[model samples]
Target: MTDEADPKGLIRESYRIEGISTGECRSIFVDWALSLGPAMTPPAAIALLIARYAAANPGHPMNAVLSDGLEAPPEARRRGGRAARVAG
Candidate 1:
């Protein structure tokens, strides 16, 4: 049942790892997101992952991380630049 969305099985393995922490799940989620091809939307991939694994383990911490991915992404914010430095 491995899907192209999770080609490396990182998300799937996260589900199987007992006592995995939220921080670890977040790191794994980032890795999984970065692995997606340009054609794959993170929301679509995350929805698929939740459907595939969440039902079996409603308590998994990965579920929260994946669910968090579904949120509207924060708008890009500039951190540092000549303008920022000048303003500061």
Candidate 2:
């Protein structure tokens, strides 16, 4: 199955296979940011955590479900937004 079809499982598996703690994961994410450009601020790191959590739980109720006539944030929307658009 694809990541979208089983994000939580993918995350758990990734963590297990990588032998990395959540803290380590967060640190690596920050390291990646630093390597790409500048050091990551606390706010940026928190945002990255939130984003990674969401990515690792795409089918989660909070991520997948929406109230009638209510729209998710542009970031959370399934299509034509930054993450999905970029992935596509």
Candidate 3:
């Protein structure tokens, strides 16, 4: 049976790949994230993923990507534009 954090096994298969790059792991992670059910939150899912795989596969690239997922997102900033130049 599949785990709720990885119902489709995308993360599991990603770890099995030989020489999987961080970029590739990132891609697989996106798919995995989108596939998560509404009941799951990203951080909780990522924590589960790490707990499930990290000890046995410490060097796996997916681990780094998963950790990155838990970090707070960067501040959103608007670049210069017509709106920025205009005053209300």
lDDT (CA) per prediction: 0.89, 0.40, 0.91
- Candidate 3 weakest lDDT stretch, 10 residues: 79-88
Clashing pairs for predicted structure model 1, backbone only: none
- Candidate 3: count of backbone clashes, pairs at least 3 residues apart or interchain: 0
RMSD over all Cα atoms, model 3? 3.5
Q: Locate the minimum summed-lDDT window of 10 residues in model 2.
A: 61-70
lDDT of 3 by residue, 3-71 (tens): 788889999999899999999999999999889987788899999889989899989999999999999
lDDT of 1 by residue, 9-86 (tens): 999999989999999999999898888877678888899999999999888999999999999979999877688779
Q: Relative to the unseen true structure, what is the C-alpha lDDT of residue 4 in candidate 1, on a scale of 0 to 100?
A: 77
TM-score, cand. 1: 0.81
- Against the true structure, candidate 3 reaches a TM-score of 0.86
Estimate, for each residue in 15-69, the C-alpha lDDT of model 2 and write its tens digit.
Answer: 3443445555444443443443234443444344446665765443332221211
On a 0 to 100 scale, what is the lDDT of residue 59 in model 3?
92
Off by over 4 Å in 1: 75-83, 86-88
